[model samples]
Target: MRLMPDEHQVRSLDHQWQLGNTRGQMRTWGRGQFRWTTFDLSVERGPDGKRRIKKTTLTDTADLKNPLRDAVLAMGWSWRARLSKL
Candidate 1:
């Protein structure tokens, strides 16, 4: 499936892509004191013959900082951290 974003968003994405920030690395964003992980963008040709985001696949570093666990804890869940968990 193809994903579309507005021109402003596309410009931001293009800027990131051009800077090589989205290359072989998982993007991170800060939420309060926690850093959250995000997927890498994959591009593909759309039906209209235009390039678009095909999918967002999670990177192998999902567990690097335990973002998922932090999210669960933030939601007041009784969770335990496991080794190499995603």
Candidate 2:
């Protein structure tokens, strides 16, 4: 999947916030309006203790809201804190 140029920071398992990569496809429809849909967030941690994400071809079919809630419960962080307009 092709992701947007920018990424939004999200809290992960570590309790510290980090960038979450969004994966989706750009679609053109209805009077040339383009939109990205069915996007999902992914967060990863590197050896240096900084979080990073790598692109993956597979997209999880599960609902994102549940996982976001789980993150909040597990890490005690608000998902809305760093959310963007997208």
- Candidate 2 lDDT, tens digit per residue, 24-77? 345322321122234445788889999987665454423544666566557644
Off by over 4 Å in 1: 1-32, 55-86
Model 1 Cα shift for residue 4 (angstroms):
47
Q: Which residues of candidate 2, in runs, are more than 4 Å off? A: 1-62, 81-86
Q: Please tell me which predicted candidate would have the highest TM-score against the true structure.
A: 1
Question: Could you tell me which residue pairs clash in candidate 2?
Answer: none
Estimated TM-score for each candidate = 0.27, 0.22
The digit string of per-residue lDDT tens for model 1 on 1-86 reads 01223311110011112122546465543212222446777889988999998667565444653565465457555343322212
Q: Relative to the true structure, how large is the alpha-carbon lDDT of every model? A: 0.41, 0.42
